[model samples]
Target chain A: MENYIPVLLLLGFAIIVASSILVLSWWLGPKKPLAVKLSAYECGVNAEGSPHAPFASKFYLVAVMFLLVDVEAAFFFPWALVYKESLQLGPILFVALVIYVAIFALGLFYIIKKDCLRLR
Target chain B: MNTVDIAILVAKTLLFYLIVLHVVPIMVWVERRGAALIQDRPGPNRVGPFGLLQPVADFVKFIFKEDPIPTGANRGLFLVAPALILIPASLTLAVLPFGDKVKLFGREILLQVADLDIAILYVLAIGSLGIYGILFGGWASGNKFSLMGALRASSQVISYEIPLGLAAVGAVAVYGTFSLREIALAQDGLWFGWLPRWGIFLQPVGFWLFFIASFAETNRLPFDLPETEAELVAGYHTEYGSMKFGMFMMAEYMNLTTISGVMVTLFFGGWHLPFVADAMLLKWIGSQNLLGLVQVVIFLTKVAIFLCVFVWVRWTVPRFRFDQLMRITWGRLIPLGIVNLLVTAGVMLWLGGWK
Candidate 1:
């Protein structure tokens, strides 16, 4: 817990420095809002729809795929750290990793096959 | 722990902040000057000494400039976003070792701010949170383009992060430790009397994957779909102006340094140089304080070179289309990263396992 003092201190320093800049700019910088300027930028035309409108499912799919792949990748870290130790226990760990990766690969293949990753 | 220990820690943390902030202006100068050199033009020479004062000038401008929050924008979130990005980006620097230690007046001072057991995990977790700054800035802007930019940045970050983790798995397999200092110490000796026992030498594919993934993760050129002015008009920070924008920019450069520092710590031996053992240098120097300073210099030099590479790659490569970026992350880099992990495991297993 003592080791975390510096981390917390650094965090405090970071926040102080960052917020000081924001506050400085706020205090010093001029502010004069116009409707034309306040409106969302849209290449000179008025914005057509709400900014919060739903986007494509491709984006959603990409995010979901990230979850699947990222979690698998996370699991790999501990496994890698213990690979040598676990290998001494038996070849079972190696076989388990093989099966794990195979399943992951199969899912990746299926995703690719379905074109779930494509933007359009 | 004690008065001296607390004092040293405070001093180190202060020094780290100063150095990182100092690097921001230097990096700004280098990126502009380097980008100019790449594009065959003179860049910012009119300001103090080859545009050294250009960042100062920009800072002044940012301070005096008007920062108008849009009519429909969420003012609170719009104001908070830059700080979100800046803090996390700077926070990751706490765990990275610039040098081993200095023996000062019968006491020892560690070069790093913290030596946490979960240093790498801390870095990954904090680094990922940096995207929220972009997300908030985009969403609060009340702009279509800003939202698009936020989506792009978040998705790109998430996609590349998988490969980045996998790449680290290979390195962890080699080192068996998450502490950056321990990893650096492990690479102190030469591999074959000439070659350094660096991660790059042992895990070439892992290094490559990490390098490329870091590049993408930083939202740099060739992968800067988040901020491609041609499409989303300055991307996530479209509505931000003045120092709010500067904070984001500062955070970006800081993130670059953080990533470069991590790469150096992980793959390039941090402060370790080829064929020159620290013990030999320490003996020659005869003063641990001086050795610590020298080690810090060497570590900074390597990070500086990589930062230049980041700038160079930015100016050289064409920006990838969003789809291509995603496909590369999902298709090529991930599988290769997995393969690298497996091969590294297999070889380490065959080579008597990790020591």
Candidate 2:
């Protein structure tokens, strides 16, 4: 909490800038709203059934799952950069990271074989 | 504080702040001009000398533009988003060492805002938070495009910041230092007194990883998915107008600064101008007085060069598809970051630098 000054300062700046922009845009930018214009844009086609229609879960599911594994793989990057220097940090951390990566990779392979990414 | 101290402090702060503001416009000019050259067209020639006043014209145009709040949007968050980003953008500079030193009034001064022991970690944490502005801006805008942009912004930042941190760890391993000044000074001389500058010569892979990761972290082209114009309109700030738009612009330039600063501190030797033939030039020119002016200039020049790179690439390279972006971060970059880290650690351990 004591060292929160920097974070706090940053938050304050964000709040200040965000508010000013909203106000300025409201005051200065053009404005015209017709029912058709306000409706969800469907790329020049007639109105869609609903703007908030539910999307198929598969695309998003694959995306999230990919991100999960993707993020996991990214975790290895930092550790790997420090790999040769691992003795200073702790010898076993490298081995642990290796095991961790192996397990993580196994999950990836399982998903790959299961065909989670296939678009049918 | 004494009168002299108070006067000096105020003068320094004002100068620093003003310079920070001024840098963005120069960067903008250079970017446009460089892009024009890259694309084989005149970028901006109408306004003033070398199109220098274009940013100023842009500022005037933006300020006069109307502000509009969507009828049912989250007004507070919409307004707060840009603030969140620009703040972190500026604060990261607090710990960067501009140069060795400068002298004034018979006293030496440090060119940095502050030198905390945990400078690197502070930069990482601050960098991570810059995304909140985009997140809030997009969320608050209440447009589907804005929301999509915000989500993409956070996701991309999270993915890229990891490798950026990892690459820097290799530098730390070899130098055994987290202080930016320490890192710069350590890289000052040639290995055999005539070899070359340093850092890049020793840790080329680490430098490349760090440089690439910084590019991606700043959301520049090839990695700029948050505001991917083709996909998400104008991205996070799609609903923004007037000053809110200005904030986004300001943050973009500042983020560019932050990335450049970090790059110089980590990879290039910061403010250590080579080809100096005189000892007095190194001594007198390095006093806190001369340093405050020289340090900022040196730093800005390095940053400006990189800003041109940003523009050059923006004009030259088409942005990656989302799948490709994800693949690069997850497959190529992360593994490379880890490998680089391991190699650095191995060398450091062998050299007894670890103990």
Candidate 3:
């Protein structure tokens, strides 16, 4: 955890730098608030309706798929760290890795078969 | 930590902060000038020699320009979004080891700002958070184009992130550690007394996968569907003006630099010159501090080359269609990454566990 101190300090420095720039820009920038200028850009014509309309369910499907795969990928990190040592010991760990990946590959194939990735 | 340790820490943090800050404008200049070169025109020669000062001029313009909050926009998220993006981009520098340790003030000081045990994990976690800036910026703007852009950007980032993580996993398995410094150190020396023992040689497929995924992660051309000017009208930041938009631009370039740094650390021998051992260089240089400085220059040179490749690709390739972008990551890259990981593990075992 001591290793994380510099990371925290770096984050603090970044926050200070980023916020200061935003403040500088806000302070120096002109603020002319004509109704036309303040309105959302729509090329030229006025924007109609709320921008919060429902989007395609495919996007939600993609998010769900991402969660599943990302968690699996996260698991690989710890396994990856120990993999070389485990292989040196025996083939058990290597076989286990293959099985784990095989199961995940099955899930990936299912995702592909369902066509969740198709943007059409 | 003692007072001296604290001071050293503060100095390293500031140094890295300045490096990331400087890289943004330099990248902006390179992008414009490189684009012009490819298009057969003189690019921004009016501002300083070869438009070197164009970024400075651009910064001044951004500060004085009119900044307006769109009438129906979410006031709070709109303001917080840019800083959210910039912070992560800058923070990633903490784990990147610029050079070997230098002896200074009668102490051995590591060149990295933070040498975490979980450095690779830290990078991956911070990198994923950057998408929120684009998502919030787009959603808060309450413009149709911005919303569409945010949706596209979020999904795209999340999808490509799988292949990116898998590629990193391949590196970790080969090096057998999550710390980036160890990975870089492991790449030292030679293979068969001829080739440099870089990660590229051990995991060639992983390198290519990582290289391609990084382009998508940074949202550069070909994968820049989120901010495609033709359709989305500047996409996520369409409603932002002045320095808020500037922050987003800075964040993009900073992310590019960070990704490039990570690539060099992981795949290309971090601070190690190709085929030249550190001890040999140390003998020639005859000073630890001087050797450290030379290593830093070497690391930066590698990163600069990668940055040039990024700029070159941006101008050379046309943008990918949204469906095609999604298809490539999902249909092609992810499967390839998995196969690559398995094959690497199998080969490592066959070669008697990556000595």
Candidate 4:
């Protein structure tokens, strides 16, 4: 708990710096808001369509795949730290990791087989 | 913790902030000059001697330019996005061990702000949060291009992060501890009386995977599809101006510095120069405080080299197509990272164990 003081202080400092600069800019910069100037920029062309339109399922697929692999990758850190110690204890832990990886690898294989990563 | 401990922590945090603030401007100068050198042109040479004061001029311009919020923009988010990016980038620096502890004034002082036990996990988790700035800024801008840019940035960061985390796991497997200070200390000796016992030598594949993923993670060229000027204009920050834009730019360079610092801490042996023995240095310096300062200097020098490499790569490589970026992350880097981790595990088992 004591180790976190600096982290908390650092966060406060960042917020202060960011806010100060922003406030400074607001105080110093001119603010003459014309109707045309405030409109969202669309590369010199008038804005078209809604920004809230639905995106492709591929992005969602990518996000799902990322969650699966990323969580799997997260497990590796703790496993790596204790892997050597566990190996000395017995092959049980090692085999457990292998089985865990194998299960995910099969999922990855299925995803690839389905061409889910393809950008259609 | 005592008063002295609190004092040291505060001092170290202040020092870290100053170092980051100083480095950001230097990086801006380097990027401009380096891009010029690579493209065979004069760049920003009019401001100060060799254009060293260009960042200062740019800073003044950013402060004075009017920041316009789009009429339909989410004003709250638009205002907070820059700071959101900057916070995590700065926070990631807290766990990085810039140098070993030094004795000063009858006590010991560490060069790092916070030397956490689970430094790697802390860094990875904080680093991933940086994408939120882009996401919020883009979505709130109410611009189609900004939204597209935000999507690209978030997806790219998320995809590459898997490989980055895995590569780090490979190194951790070899090093056996997540404490960055210990990892740096572990690489203190020579492997064969000639070669430095750096993480790069031991985990070459991990280093390569980390190197590529870091480029994507930092949103540099070849992976900077999010801000590819040919398509998205200025990308997520397109709706921003004045110091708001400066905040994003500063955050990017700060991220570069922090990432490079982490890379040096992990793969390049932190504060140890190749072929220089710590014992010899201790004997020569005869003061722990001075030696620690030397170590900090050494660490900064390595980070500087990495920063230069970042700029050089940015100028050299062309932006990858969005599809290419996704394909490379999911197809090549992630798979390679897994293979590298497996091989590392196999070797660790064969060696009996990691110390």
Top of the candidates by TM-score: 3
Interface RMSD of 1: 1.5
- Ranking of predictions according to lDDT: 3, 1, 4, 2
What clash pairs does model 1 have?
none
Tens digit of per-residue lDDT, candidate 3, span B1-355:
8999889888987887788789999999999999999999988888888889999999999998887899889999999999999999988888898998998888898888888889999898999899889999999998999999999999989989899999999999999998888888887788888999898988889999999999999999979999999999999999999989999999999999999999999999999999898989999999999999998899989999999999999999999988898889988999999999989988888898868
lDDT of 4 at B298: 94
lDDT of 1 at A26: 89
Q: Which has the greatest lDDT? A: 3
Each candidate: RMSD: 1.4, 4.4, 0.9, 1.3
Kindly list the per-residue Cα lDDT of model 2 for residues A50-94, writing each as its tens digit.
322444454465557646765675455445444545565655655
The candidate that wins on DockQ is 3
i-RMSD of all predictions: 1.5, 5.0, 1.0, 1.3
- Winner on TM-score (2 vs 4): 4
User: Could you tell me which residue pairs clash in candidate 4?
Assistant: none
lDDT of each: 0.88, 0.67, 0.90, 0.87
Q: For candidate 4, lDDT tens digit of each residue in B167-230?
A: 8988888888898988999989788699998999888998988889899898998799889888
> Which regions in candidate 4 have their CA more than 4 angstroms from the true location?
none
Give the range of the ten consecutive residues with the poorest summed lDDT in model 3 chain B. B12-21
The segments of candidate 3 whose C-alpha lies over 4 angstroms from its true place after superposition are none
DockQ value for model 4: 0.74
For all the predictions, what are the DockQ values? 0.71, 0.25, 0.85, 0.74
lDDT of 4 by residue, A41-93 (tens): 88788887787677777778888989888888888888888876677786666
User: Cα miss at A34, model 3 (Å)?
Assistant: 0.3
